[model samples]
Target: MTRTTAADVRRDITARYRARTAKSRARHAEALRYLPGGETRGATRISPYPTYMTAGEGAWLRDVDGNRYLDLLNNYTSLVHGHAPPGIVEQAADQLLRGTALGTVAPPQVSLARQIVERVPGIDMLRFTNSGTEATMMMMRAARAYSGRDIIVKIDGGYHGSHDFVEISVGAEAEAGLEPKARLESRGVPSSVLQSALVAPFNDLERMAALLEAHHERVAGIIVEPMPNTGGMIPPAPGYLAGLRELTDRYGVLLLFDEIVTLRLAPGGFQQIAGVLPDLTALGKIIGGGFPVGAFGGRREIMAQFDPAQHDQALFHSGTFNGNSITMVAGEEALRRLDAAAIARINGLGERLAAGINALFAALGIRAQCLGYGSLQQIQWTDAPVVNLGDARRAAQDTGDLHALLQAELLNRGVYSSNRGMFSVTTPLQESELDLALAALKGALQTLLPYMREVAPRLLR
Candidate 1:
């Protein structure tokens, strides 16, 4: 085997993707009239144009052009059971017949809430919202209100939601020279909002501690994703989460675990595995059963702020579809089906996929690596360990062209990964699917090797 340089990988991948895009571009041109950018989500858009999928079943998506591909992306990891799982579909269909949304409390909501409270060790109570973005927004608001403080801390490169407060420092470029302290990422976010956030590097406990000490009084809470999914998946170093817990306690800052993406790690989530309980937790994706849902819950006292009965203390939380019957029924069914054994089985499959891909990279002599925690995995083009958002930015800057190449190649080979290499294994995916993926990866690498040898020779060396 010969090692492939990054430059060669980029050239080959671009060429392959360019050829594939010719087909996708035509569909996108047709779609632009109906949907902006030919897609609903910006994250789904890629160079050339997004491939339009007509339908999905199990772990496969059929594109509008009639191309079938293994759906490793899994609707951004929302379909834990894969597309249109019988259990979820049947339950949702039954609930839809009953009604979609009712203004009053629903039995399904209570049932799902009970299930969450039981599985998640730290959540003593819970409240529902329409999306993970809403859940995180409420969590931050509650933390600020509870502590009577202005500033909140978040891990650099961590993504909580699209809300203004937590969006700071997300996907920042390394060239921007972001400081150890937080830096805002968008305009019109309000200087006050930017000032209110403190950013620290993931896995850098010392820097986190320093920030905590410096802003002890003003810091109201610290929100972190147990394993950050954006900027590639970066798992916390051992004791890193525990250390954050201890520091938050010392500084009297609320600890919020944004498990929106990491919840699939286990039935109880990363908080259980790390043994570091937060004051609040945010959840979405799998819990919703393919429907849009989000939840924030923790200590009973802290959650009491949202009680509508309390006139003066109410948190003003209200949503037309919050705790709606349809979401609740579907969520409950999904939760019922997702027991410890099921989680273990899916995570095991994820481990297998990760290991297989890593082994393939080694065999192909590629300067690439797979990184993730539990079921969520990302393939980084560089060999460097991604510890924080800055590290991810640097990696992206170093290999953006290569990363883009690999993404196109993988898609052409019938494996649908996210633009950033994020892939999740659904319960439906088996060893056969993983094997196919590995083979596809090998073929992709082979196709790029010659280009690498001529271009970025250092990667091979």
Candidate 2:
């Protein structure tokens, strides 16, 4: 018998996916006439054409092909309550009729802001934006203005947003080692932007301190995801966050926590759970109640920079849809419903999902491990301790296309999630849905075993 290779598995998966998603393929072709790569967001793109989703209800998504799948990705973890929650829908509809966007701040906007400040620790005040990208950008700018520094320290492989300063070292090279010199991950980013960003290793306190110490004079802020979401959902190692807080304080540099995805992890986010607060916190995703929104806020002194009273020196900030009524009311409703109990329940489910997948991997004698903090998960094909982005980068390099193949297999089995092996549990997710996802995962693993044994036998050992 011929040894089955990963390429063979990929080819088979692609062929099957193409056959099943003919309509989506056609739609993608039609989309190519106007949109770049037939999609607006790069995350949704996948091999053999991305499935065009038609509708989503609760934790399920219906594709254009009329196939329904349990939505494990949950729109990149923006929908904590899943899709079309009754209260949010009603609130959004009401706000739409009243006005989606008003020139002045609306009642709903104030209400939502208050809710955020009350729940999320360290946010004395905040300003809304259209997306997380804008939130992070504004936070960094605020830090620069507050500290009068130009350089910003960021974790390697940490994704803040699409902004020029943050668009560096995101897909950092594993072989480059710790605190690799900032390299732009995308084209069109000027060299000045790259130079202004100092890349540091995640969870490694000593390395982080060294980077800050070396460049503390020029450093305005150290921006990080409290629990890294895009860089494989890696949690902070014990005192990692506390250490960051200490270093920032000692250096007089602001600390900005990007809680866009991890906000769903706790009632007050991972910062509350960890008990380490930053000077500024960037929030998005679930806060919008399944709509577009982002915010950054912190100490009153820092946030006051945006206060119009200080006209001459105030950081100039304005957006046409900054505090849009629809998202505001919907977000307030979403936050209102996401109580402590709901957070605990969803986080518990995420833990169970990670544990179940790890058990399956162990049973199959694989070197794979499911890593993440509460309510988020990522399947890393390495047993190594994944404390930082470099470790994650190594795992990604080692796994080759295993994750992609697994993702394709999962989709084929009627489950949808990130092809990069990330998944998040929604508030409305049932235990039965998790069970089904686990079953699909197990089947996916079994199907990939031959390829694993041939291409990278260490994974099966």
Candidate 3:
């Protein structure tokens, strides 16, 4: 008898997907007329044409093809309470009528700023921006002004946001060590970004210290995601964050925590959980209550550089929609509801899902592991510890086929997630949704057995 192959299984899955998502195919074809790659952003693009979503409610999303998914990705971990949350939507609507952008700071904005300063350990004062990208950009500028330095250190493959400076060393070649080679990853970014950047690997204290020891004189700040959300959701190694604090203090360099995605992990972000505070914090995602928003705050002295009272030395910082009423009220509602209890519940669910995923992998006798912290999880096809971005890339290189199969199969069963093996649990998610996801995984694995046995036996025990 003839044996099946992974390619054959993939072809079958693609055909089925194309058949079911006919309307989406037509929609994408129409989209090709105006949008590049039939989508506005790179993250939302999916293989065999992206599924055009029409509506979302709570934890469920409806595609243009009229298919409903459990929404595991949750708009890339932005929606903690899921879509169209009643209270948040109501407040946003009310603010819309009053004024979206009134050109002055509203009481709602002041309330949010005070609320965050009270809750977060590091933030003493803050300013709002339109997106996380803008937040990181301003935070870096503040650090530079505070330290009177030029260079900034970042992690290899750690995604801060899409800007010229951060575009450096992202997706660089994985090499022998954690030090970044400083390869420019994006096209439009100037080569000068490499000069202003120093790169190090996550979870490695000694290497990090070495990088700081050499460049501490010229370094402004070390910007990091407390629990790097896009870098495979890897958690900090024990004492790693505290060690960063110590080193920054030793060198007199500021530390900036990019808590855009990791903020959902705890009440006051991973910093509070780890008991290590940075000089500045970049905030976004869940804080916006599903609106477009970002904020950067730090010690009052550092933040005062933007104050008009600074006279000639003041940095000119202003945005048309900086403290817009709609985003302010919506974000306040989101934060007000996201108490310690809600954080604990969602984090508990994340743990449960991680354990269950690992168990499933073990039962199938596959060399895979689920890695993450709190409410985030990543399916790495390697049993090797994914302590850094290099390891994540290795898994992607070796098991690209496996990753595609898993996502395609899951989507076939009314589940939705990132094409890159990421999963997150939201506050609106139910245990039943998790059960459905697990079942889909089981079926997908079972279906792939024949193909795995034939083509990718290395994945098998």
Candidate 4:
């Protein structure tokens, strides 16, 4: 019998994907003419072409090609209750008839803000925004205004949405040392960003204290994700968040939590679980019920700076759709549905999924690990534990082809996930659905055996 060549496996998966997604291919080809890279967002782009999604139901998506997939990506963890739940749809529809954007401080907007302030321990008064980008951007502004400082420290590989100042050191790897340079993530971000932002590795408390000791005078706050979703879902070291709180209080600098993604880890966000509160919190994703929304809130003293009564010193914050009725009502419904019981169920499924993947890799003699916290996990190809962005990057160094193959195979088997190996569990996901996912993962890995053996032999145990 002839061995399965890498070329053979590649052609097989490509042919299968193309055959199953003819309409998707056609739509993508048309999109390429008008949209850059044939898509609106960079994250959803796949190698052959992006899938054209038509509709979504509980934990499932129907593509233009009529294929049904178990959606593990959950629109990058935004669709917490899964796409278009009955209550969210109805609430949004009622508001839609009333008004989408009333150009005033609508009741629904206030109700949503109240819901957030009540839930999050750190948030005393909060304001809404159009996106997580806006929330984080405004959070930084509030921190700076309250503290009267210009410099902000951010964790390497911690993403607080895409704006100019926070663009520093995003997913940036160190060239020669443990710390990555404060490199800007996108172009058009001003060069002055390098001075205002200082980057440090995640899960490194000693390094964080040292940074504060050196630059605490100019630093307004130190912002980080409790568990950086993009940085391989590595949990914070036991006292990492507590240590940060101590450091910030000692240095007279504010502490900020970017719970844009990690908020769903618990009912009140990761801060509640860690028993640490931030002076400011930036939120997005699940809070909006799959709509475009964002919010930031913190201590009364700091947030009071934004009050109109403060006169000249007050930070005038306003947006046309800051508290739009549609998103506000929809978001309220979303949060209401995601109670503690629902969170626990999904988190159990997520842990099971993570464990199943790790067990499968070990059984198959593959050197890989799936590390994560409640309801979230990420696959890193290297055997080493991923504690920070540098560790994650080094683990990913030689597994591009392997990852691409596995993702394609998983798609072919009716599972959809992020190309970056991040998987999120939605409230609608069931134990039975998890069984199908594990089967698909096993099938994908088995299919990729030959390719891994040939191209990434070091990955074999």
Candidate 5:
């Protein structure tokens, strides 16, 4: 009997992936000439090249190689209604016929803005942008303008976006201290950008309060994700969001919630559920109806920074495609369709998926946990409580290889998900689809256990 090492399992998986995705490989090779690493987005890049998708619909994607997959990635949780819902497509097409970019305030844009202002608890007024990165960037700028402060506090491992300021300390190596240093995520991000931002741990209210207290005077705002999707789908501890609200109020520093991912958690977003409101909220993803969009808004006084009436003191905010007709109509349709019932259905599936995976890991004697809220979930490979980014980082480091192997195996089995172990349940996902995904995950774990035993004996319970 041959004892298969971790490397052997990975080799087999890579071979299978390559054989099934030859067209994807060729396309990637051609793409590499124009795009760096053969992709525009960094997260979609997989080792041995990535699968090239030709089309997607109703929670399924068809690859260029003609292989079909259950799309759990859902465009990084942007596709709440799954790929190109009939309504969204029709709405977008209608808008395209009317005008894609009218270069004026379209009626659909105003209508959608009104809906958002009425729904989201934190937004009184909002300005749209091209992406979530722009939303967060503008939020920070508005915060600085309102507070007349230069420094901003951000959560370690919380992925706001790729913009210069928020690009600090996201999934950086954990330091051996209470106060974490702000490490630059990208090379071109200036050191001065890092200097302007203070990094704090997610879910650590006491430590965050202390750090904020020390830097209260210079701090403009504290930006955070209500439920951090990137840092292993770590949810805030009970009363954590409330504590942050209190701290921000006490210190006179603005609170900014990056609800780009967590907005799908509730009609009014995580803030509505948690009963904690931010001074400014950054939104994107699902709100765009699967199109590219972003928005930031807050209290009337704070959001006045973008008011054209006060030109002298106003923080200049404008984009070529901001509130374009296509995105605005599409977003309106998406939000109109995403009711409480739909949210509940998808979230329920997510809970079931998480529970099923956790039960499987426990039964198989694997030291791992599935953690998330609402429709989002991730498999953290360590038993340690994910109280902060440091804990999550340590846990990931301990089982990085095994986690990668699990992702590859799941992909080979027709389930597509993020390599970082994150997956979302789309509105179109059915109970049967969820069952199949869980079954695939269970099979992946069972098949990979021998390799786990070879590489990580201590992981066995």
Candidate 6:
């Protein structure tokens, strides 16, 4: 493939996507009346309206319109074993026959907790929640209660969940009034909450140290995604996580690792890979085996804040659907199946896919790159090294034309990935699936090259 400019690629891809979207617009128009943005999640919405998936199995998903495509997105990397895996389905169905939510103790809950405790080294005791958002919220509450402090620190571009406290500064642009150190991105997130949340650039140990020093006594915790998933899967730099641990300890602040997405990176999640354990760990996604579940656990001394036995405990955490039998059964089975060997195998597939994509970009002379860690990968249309959210924001702006074209062309070619080019490899995906994806990617790139040539001549040069 010949080198092409970004603008020409954008124009060509947009033309094709507009035509395809025209046919789907009627359905989307009807959906918008009931569902905001014609989608269930904020991130899932994209131009041309997102394709509504009907069913999924193994490494493939079929849309409502009968379009079948390889399931590279993997339900945002939650379905590590792939959709409707036999073990997960069977366990869930068995538990469903018994009951859904008893609002009481169930055997499966204990079973799943044990599995998690056994797998994750840092977790001593665990509490269940309905979603990662809820788990992270509970983590913050626990951190505050344990430290008797109000403020929390988060990495820039890190996404813990949709909760107001942690959502600040995520996906915020520099022009959006985001300060280099900290800024609030959402309204109704009380000024108190905003004031309590501090942001530090990822991979910047010195800046983080400065923030910790400034906030010292008032900082309850330092919460971060061990690997930033929201801003295109940027891995933590060497010693970066260890540095955070040291700083948090120095300031007497709790260190919380939000591994909701990164849990799939290893059997013990990024903490194991980074070799730095946190005071608390937030978990979700693959742990639930495609079911809704969230959990937070750490040192028993700190986690006792949630114990009902503690009369004067300052923290309270409870949810009706938490520890629901169906979710517990599914999660238990999922974790049971997700051994170290399985994790390594899935990661191997991701490495292969990433290598192929990077090679394609080099061969085609496109200023694109793949970034991720273990089963998760994101395509960035910039040659710049992305270390922090600021870097991601810059990359997004500089390569907007190329990103628009790449997404449209990939969609048209029947390869579904997140709008930001996030893709995950499931256990069920074989080399053949990888080959198909690579071929589809090649075709899409070839089709958009003419447009790229017209748009950004300097990029191709």
Q: Candidate 4 lDDT, tens digit per residue, 309-410? A: 864678988888888888989999999988889888888989999999999999999999999987988998878777887788777776647766777778
Tally clashing residue pairs in candidate 2. Answer: 0
Across residues 1-461, which tens digit of lDDT does each residue of candidate 2 receive? Answer: 87777778878888888878889999999999999988988888887678899999999999999888899999899999998998899989988888788889789889999999999988999999999999999999999998888899988889988989899999855874544778988889888897688888788789888887888999999999988878578888889999999999998889899999888888789899899999999999999998899999999999999987964588988888998888899999999999999998998999999999999999988898999976899988789788777777777775667877877888889999997899899988999999999999999898899888877788878
Clashing pairs in 2: none
Query: lDDT of each prediction vs. the true structure?
Result: 0.82, 0.88, 0.86, 0.88, 0.88, 0.81
**Where does model 5 exceed 4 Å of error?**
172-177
- Taking all chains together, each candidate's TM-score versus the true structure is 0.93, 0.97, 0.97, 0.98, 0.97, 0.93
lDDT of 5 at 327: 93
Candidate 5 to truth, TM? 0.97
Candidate 2 TM-score to native:
0.97
Tens digits of per-residue lDDT, candidate 5, 342-452, equal 888889999998999899988998998889997999988776677777777777775637766777788889999988788899988989998899898988898888777
Cα lDDT, model 4, residue 423: 93
Tens digit of per-residue lDDT, candidate 6, span 148-232: 8988888777788888888687864444334465566677776667778888777888877887787788999989888788866
Residue-level lDDT of model 3, residues 1-461, one tens digit each, is 76777778888888888888999999999999999889978888788888888999999999888999988889899999998998999999998988888887789999999889988999999999989999999999999988999898988888988988898776734764645676787888899888889888777778879988999999999998888777488888888999999999998999999999988887888999999989999998888889899999989999999987764698877788887889899999999998999899889888888898899889999888899987898888778788888777766775646776777777888889888889988888888888988888888887777677766677789
Worst 10 residues of 3 by lDDT: 172-181
Better candidate number, 1 or 3, judged by TM-score: 3
Q: Model 5: how large is the Cα RMSD against the reference?
A: 1.3
* CA RMSD per model (angstroms): 2.8, 1.4, 1.4, 1.2, 1.3, 2.7
Model 1: weakest 10-residue lDDT segment is: 397-406
